[model samples]
Target: MYRTPALLAPLALALAASAFAAGEHDHAHEHQPLHGGVVVEVKDVDYELVARPAAVQLHLRDHGKPADVSQASARLTLLTGTDKQEAVLRPAGGKLEAAGSFRLAPGTKAVVVVTRPGKPAATARFTLK
Candidate 1:
């Protein structure tokens, strides 16, 4: 009985250590964006924003799979130096898009707020070039 308890102690400690280490593993390894865009995590969902001069695009992903945004709406705020602009985004082909002239130079800051029916709004912030 004494030997069995002693053997189980080390096994329990090893299992605990492994569980701790697994929890400590970096989350970045799982959030890489397929599109060349800046990504932010909010409420276990990944929002990838692609800014351009002609339009701004936002992609949604959940657990590395494309998420449906057909019933969602978004608002984008862009800040560059002292100039600021806001646009309302609508769902377009599995992504959210706003068509407008935007100043998306390097160091520009963007804040995106997305809303869906019966769900709380989700927000993400990004700096883009």
Candidate 2:
């Protein structure tokens, strides 16, 4: 009986070491983002709102775990040349997309604000080039 405990101690230590090594291996291939917390992907479909040729299409994707977006709200501000327009986004096709009246061009700067239910609001800035 005493020998069994002695054997178990070594086994536990070996298992722990293996787990640590595996974690280190995973870290090598992991790509860490600049900021922490969940990430939302925003894609402008047909809009450039900056360069002045294509219409803007904003695609907001939840890169984190799936959560309810019923209460979520989003606002996008697009700066195109000398004009600026604000778009209020609504949830559509599991993403929030807002269409602007004017065609936004590439290399334009945009501000997006997303508010999820029961979570603090998040804001992101992107340049569509």
Candidate 3:
């Protein structure tokens, strides 16, 4: 009886350890953001502002698939000289584009938030002058 109990003790400990590991792994996956259907290429993103035209243009290229940008929507909040401006983005020519009517001066910061129809939302940071 002593030998049997000792053998079972190790098996019980192993089972407990395995259960704890699996639970931790499951929790990690649960908290991860699921990037919807769009695969964003962060390195290819560019932002340009035309102060005279009072417009800001966002350029994004998706080499993955044509449908990636089609269903994506974007919103931008620009911080310019202590003032904030918001712009709505629309799908245009394989990219999600946003144009602001307010003239963006140099040293402006912009935060772009994009949401895809079925995928996880993503954000991009840019500067405008």
Candidate 4:
């Protein structure tokens, strides 16, 4: 039986649109910082960095829920103009914490390298304005 193009066009379009939406939904998520930090997503995981004047915090989440980072460690390197600083982050409670005064200023940049058990290392970059 022959079908009219007008009848088939919408059906085909709907199928295509739905497939695209489903694929996108499964691959990426909207990023919102839960801890007043800059949020970055890497392979469906979210990393939030809250760089304070005297402390540094790194929060992790997967799919909007707090991620288990008990076995994870991160190294944060801060860059502000010609001055540079680095800190080792140990898992403290839900976030990785480090104690020290970071000379954070406007236009500062941070590069974090996170290592989790049995997973490849992930790196995220953030900038403070």
Compose the digit string of candidate 1's lDDT tens values, residues 1-129: 358988999999999999999867355536776778899888778999988899889999876678889999999999999999999999999999999899878999999999988879998999885
Task: Report every candidate's CA lDDT.
Answer: 0.89, 0.54, 0.57, 0.90
Off-target runs (Cα >4 Å) in candidate 4 are 1-29
Worst 10 residues of 1 by lDDT: 23-32
Residue 124, candidate 2: C-alpha displacement in angstroms: 0.5
**Model 3 compared with the native: what TM-score?**
0.52
Sort the predicted structures by lDDT, highest score first.
4, 1, 3, 2
| Candidate closest to the true structure, highest lDDT | 4
Error of 1 at 94 (Å): 0.1
Question: What is candidate 2's lDDT per residue for 40-95, written digit by digit as tens?
Answer: 24321111122233233333333433335566767778787888888776665554
Ten residues in a row with the worst lDDT in model 4? 21-30
**lDDT score for residue 113 of model 1:** 92
| Candidate 1 vs 3: which has more TM-score | 1
RMSD of every candidate to native, in Å, equals 5.9, 11.3, 10.6, 4.9
Q: Write one digit per residue (lDDT tens) for candidate 4, span 12-129.
A: 9999999888867564457888889899888788999999989999999888889888999999999999999999999999999889989998789999999999989999999986
Query: Worst ten-residue run, lDDT, model 2?
Result: 43-52
Evaluated against the true structure, the overall lDDT of model 3 is 0.57
TM-scores, each model vs. reference: 0.77, 0.51, 0.52, 0.78
Task: State candidate 4's TM-score.
Answer: 0.78
Q: 1 or 2: which has the higher TM-score?
A: 1
Better of 2 and 4 by lDDT: 4
Whichever of 2 and 3 has more lDDT, that candidate is 3
